[model samples]
Structures are given as C-alpha cells and as structure tokens.
Target: MRKIIAQLFISLDGVVEAPDQWHFPYFNDEMGVAVDSVLGRADTLILGRRTYDSFAGAWPEREAAGGEDAPFAKILGDARKIVVSRQQLEFTWRNSELIKGDLVEAVTALKKEPGDSAIAMSGSVSVVRQLLAAGLLDQLQLLVHPIAVRKGMRLFDEGDAPIPLKLLSSETFETGVLHLFYAPAEQAGEGTYEDAKAHLPQDER
Candidate 1:
C-alpha cells in the first residue's frame, strides 16, 4: 500500500498558511535535504483547490523561465496531481486531474493501488485535516519554524475532535527549526497531576 504523507511548513503557533511570508529566513541545507527527502519518495501529489491554483499559477511559469527554481518546478509539473474541490475547475497544468466522487473514497482507493512510492499532500491544510480525521493519513511530517505568525489558517481548527499522534522520528536544524514526523496512534495516554508528581524532585513533591 502506498503511504499518504502530509507535509507542512508550520510556525511555532501552529500556523500553516503563507509560508512564503515567513518561511525562508530560516532555510538551510538541512531543511532542503529534509524537504527533498519527502518529495523524492512521492510520485503523486494531492492538493486542495487553493494550493492547486497557487501552484498552477506559479510553478509552470517558473519551469518555463528555467530559473534556479525551475528544476523543482519541473518536478511538480511532471508529477500526477489530484486536486480536491467541490466546485468545478479548469485544469491548465499538465498531468493534473480533479478528484472524482467522495474525497475519502477516492483517497482510500488511491492508497489501495499497487505502488511502492508515496502519495504526498503538500500545503493543503483542509485536505490533510480531512484525511487525518478519516484515518487515511499515514504520516504527518512537519518542519516547525521557531517564530510565531500569531494569525493565519492553522492545521487544526477550533472544536475539532482530539486526534492522537505518535512521534516516529525528530531532528533539529541549526536554524532552530524542528523536523517532526508522526503517525496516527490508537489513543493518547492519560495521567493525573498526582501521577506526574511521581517524577518530580523530592523537594518539589
């Protein structure tokens, strides 16, 4: 089964929107390697309507310009893109297709397909959240920056049901950005204040 991975560039306050505005100041070779590692494993890209539009408008142009970003742009342009949207859209980008039928069903079927490579969802916060809630997301990879944006569209919204995740691995970059990889877990462990006191210093206890 192909793993469905959701990769995001998030802020300290959990904001995932507008990475371009605050994301690059901390960029380094380590972060580049981490991002490329995730992209290298995925042959298919799933995106929300907004993210799809944004990429469609920019990456193709960048590819044509043959700039420093062109190589990465070509990767995005060549990958099979599945766009999720309720309303109809005209797909101008090559190898792009709108998702058919129910979102969960479509993604479930995609996961069952024969493939060793991964299916990656990048920058589509809503789609990621939906898939995570439906128990379809296999891995959640986050590059958490040290700064707080304070206001923007966050990954999790208010009143959302609690979802438990287990850390698979983690690494810290010199820029103070944390690369965290997580997978869904059965349930979150519970403990009381008195239970926590067991590990406290003798004087504090």
Candidate 2:
C-alpha cells in the first residue's frame, strides 16, 4: 500500500495559511532539496480544492518556462492529481481528476490503489485533519519555520484534539527551518489516545 504523506509548511505558531506572505525569505538550497525529495517520493498528488486551484494556475506556466523550478512544475503538471471537491470542476491542468464522494472512504481506497506514495500539500488543513482523524495519514512532514505569522490559519487551532506522533527523523536547515518527520504513534493499551497523553511532557499536556 502506498503511504499518504501530508507535507506542510508551517510557522512557529502552527499557522499553515498563506505561506506566500512569510515563507519566501527562508527558501534556500536546502529547502529546495527537501521539496524535491518530497516530490520525488510521490507519483500522485492529493490536493484540496483551494490548493488545487492555486497550483493549477501557476505550475503549468512555470513548467513551460523551463527554469530551475521547471522540474517541480513538471511534477505538479504530470503527477496524477486528485482534487477533493463536492462540486464539479473543469480541470485545466493536465492529469487532474476530481473526487466527489465520501472523502474518507474515497481517500482510503485511493491509498490502497497500486501506486507510489502520495503527497498532500498546502491549504488542505480540513482534508488533512480528516485524514489524521481517520488514521489514514501514514506520515506527516512538517517544514517548520522560525517566525510566527501571529494571525493566520493554523495547522492545529481551537477545538483541535491532540494527536499522537512518533518522531521518525529531523533535520535543521541553515535558514532556521526544521524538517520534522513523524508517524502516528500506536495506540497505547486500547484506551483513547487522550489516555496516552498522560505520558507526554507537562508542557505538551
């Protein structure tokens, strides 16, 4: 089975929205390599409607321009793109498909289909949260920047419940961004995940 990995660029305060406003300064060679690695891992792309729209609007043009970014643009343009939406969409980008059904079931089936691991990118918080809640997300790669956005859509916001994550690895870039890789922690003793929270650090608790 292919792993469903949700890769997010978030600020110190957990804000994941509009990285365009605060993320450019930190982009460096290391970050480029990290992004390339993520793209290399997936032959399929799972995107929420907003993210899909944002990507479809730009990547195609970049792919045509042929520059340092052309490789990523090609991946975005050529990968099997699945946009999760309830309404019909006229896909302008190549190799794009619309998924309009029970999100959980549909995603679950997609993950089980034979293919390389899939990666989900920005502006897909709601969909990512659903995958996390349903235990469908196999991994989460968070590129955490040092600066805080102060006020924006955060990855973990109000009303969000704690999710257990076991750290798999981490790397620190010279630009002050941290690449944190994690997998879901196995359930402890059959109780709810909240029950396992007792073992977490006081600051986290």
Candidate 3:
C-alpha cells in the first residue's frame, strides 16, 4: 500500500489558512522551496472540494500570468489529482479526475492501488483530518510558521487520538519556519516490522 503522507503549513497557534496573508500574496520563496521538496517525495494528489475550487480558479492560467514555476501550479499541471467533489464538473487542470464518494473509502482504494510513488495531501484541511483520523497517514511533514492567528481553520481537527510520533528530522528556514518530519514511533526492542506484524494482529499494528 502506498503511504499517505500529509505536508502542511501551519502557524504557531494552529491556523492553516493564509499563513502568508489573510487575503493576498499567498506565495513566498520559503513556501515555494518547501513545496518543491515535498513534491519530489510523492506522486498522487488528493484534495477536498473547497481546496479544489480554489485551485481550479488559479493554476491553469498561472503560466500565462508568469507563475507556472509556482510550486502548486507546476505540480497541478502534471500530477494525477483526485478532486473530492460531489457535483460533477470538468477540470481545467490536465491529468485530473473528480472523485465523488466517501472520502475515506475513496482514499483507501487509491492507497491500495499499485503505485510507485507515495500519496500526498495538500491544502485540504477536511481531507487531511479524515486521513489522520482513519490512521491512513504514514508520515507528517509540517512547516511551522511563527505567526499566530486569532481564529481560522486548522490542520488537525477534533477527535485525534494521541498517536505518538518519532521525530525524524528538523530544520529551520531563513523565514524562521521549522520544517519537522515525524513518523509513528517504533516500539522499544521491536524486531523488524515483518516480525512485529506476525506477532500483532493486523488491526492492532
């Protein structure tokens, strides 16, 4: 199964929306580099309806507007994306599909499908929450911004169990952001994962 990895940008106070600004100037060199790095790590894309709508209006025309090199625009133009939407709609971006189904089931099927690259979640808080709650996420990459918003949507919603994470790596950017990589902690004295799997029931592991 392809691991579903979530790469998110968040503020110190847990705001996922508009870390650059609430209204405009959404791109920055720091954000661009971060996204480009993550894109190199995955192939499949999944997004919620709101994020899809927002992206559809922006990326296709971005090249003509001299923004094709933008991290999202470049990837959206090429990567295979499953846009989770109930309403049927034609996609403006190339290599995109509109998936209208239960988010968890649909994502689960996608992960099960044979693929070389890992799946990734971007810009969609609702979809990210669903993946995290379902225990579908294999790794988390967070670029933590220093700003604190009074109120806004966040990356992780309620009902998230305290699944322990082992810190894999951490680095700071010139913008004062911290890039943290985390994966589920390996149990102490645990043998190879295959050996561990044989001992624990599939569901428990």
Candidate 4:
C-alpha cells in the first residue's frame, strides 16, 4: 500500500498558514534537501482547494519563466494533482483532476491503487486534518521553524479529540528548524503522578 504523507512548514507556535510571510527567512540548503526528500517519494499530489488555487496560480508561471525555481515548478507540474473541493472547478493545469465521491472513501481507494511512489499532501491544513482524523494519514512530516507568528490558522484547533502520535525520526538544521516525522499510534497511556515517579530525573525524584 502506498503511504499518504502530509508535509507542512509550521511555526514553533503551530501556525501553518501563510508560510510565505515568515518561512523564506529561514530557508537553507538543508531545508531544501529536506523538502526535496519528501517530494521525491511522491508521484501524486493531493491538495485542498485553497492550496491548489495558490499553487496553480504560481508554479506554472514560474515554470514558464525558467529561473532557479523552474525545476521545482516542473516537478509540481509533472506530478498528478488531485484537487479536493465541494464546488466545481475547471482545472487549467496539466495532469489535474477533481476528486470524486466521498473524500475518505476516495483517498482510501487511492492508497490501495498500485503505485511505487507515495501520495503527498502539502500546505492543505484542512485536508491534512481530515485525513489525520480519519486515520488515513500514514505520516505527518513537519518542518518546524523556530518562530511564533502569534496569529494564523494552526494545525490543531480547540475542541479536537486527542490523537496520539509516535515520533519516527527527527533532525535539527543549522537554522534551528526542526524536521519531525510522526506516525499515528495507539492511545497514549494515562498514569497517575505516582505511577510516573519512577521515570522522573534523579534530582527531581
């Protein structure tokens, strides 16, 4: 089965919106490698309407201009893009299509389809949240920048049910950005303070 990975550039305060406003300052070669690693594993891209709109508006133009960003734009252009939205939309970009039927069911089917590469979802907070809640997201990769925007749409919102996660791996870049990879896990154990005392530091104990 192909894995469904959700990759996002998030702030230390958990904000996932408008990375263009704050993310560029911290971009480095390490970050580029990290981003490329994720994109390299995925042949298909799943995007929410908002993210799709934003990408469609920019990447194609960048590809046409043929500059430093053109290679990256071409990567996006060549990949099969699945746009998820309730309203109808005319897909102007090549290899783009609208998702059919229920979102969960459609995605579940996509995972089962024969494919060597994984399916990637980037910059679609709502789509990522829905997939996470449905237990369809196989991996959640976060590039955690060391800054707090204080105000923006965050990955996790209030009143959400607790979703346990297991850390698969992590890395720290020279820029102080943390690359965290996580997978869904069983519910975390609940223990009393006395039950946890055995794991406390010696000084604290």
Candidate with top lDDT is 4
Please, what are the lDDT tens digits per residue for candidate 2 over residues 1-205? 7788888999999999999999999999998888877765578888999989999888899989998889879877878888988889999899999985898888888877886566555558888888888899998999999998899888975555668889999999999899999989865445776888888788744
**Tens digit per residue, CA lDDT, model 1, 1-205:** 7899888999999999999999999999999888777775578999999999998999999999999989888888888999999999888999999999999999999999998889988899999989999999999999999999999999898755889999999999999999999999988678899999998788844
The lDDT, on a scale of 0 to 1, for candidate 3 is 0.74
Q: Which stretches of candidate 1 lie over 4 Å from their true place?
A: none
| Top-down lDDT ranking | 4, 1, 2, 3
Q: Write candidate 3's Cα lDDT for 45-162 as tens digits.
A: 8877777777777777784576545655666667887887778878777778987578788878888999888787777887776676677878888878777776888766666355
Give lDDT per model, in order: 0.92, 0.85, 0.74, 0.93
Ranking by TM-score: 4, 1, 2, 3
The reply for model 2, stretches above 4 Å from the true place, is 119-122, 187-205
TM, every model:
0.94, 0.87, 0.76, 0.95
**lDDT of each residue in 36-64, candidate 4, tens digit only:** 88775578999999999999999999999
Model 3 bad stretches (over 4 Å): 20-30, 66-72, 185-205
How many pairs of residues collide in model 4? 0
Model 4 ranges off by over 4 Å: 201-205
Residue 5's C-alpha lDDT in candidate 2? Answer: 81
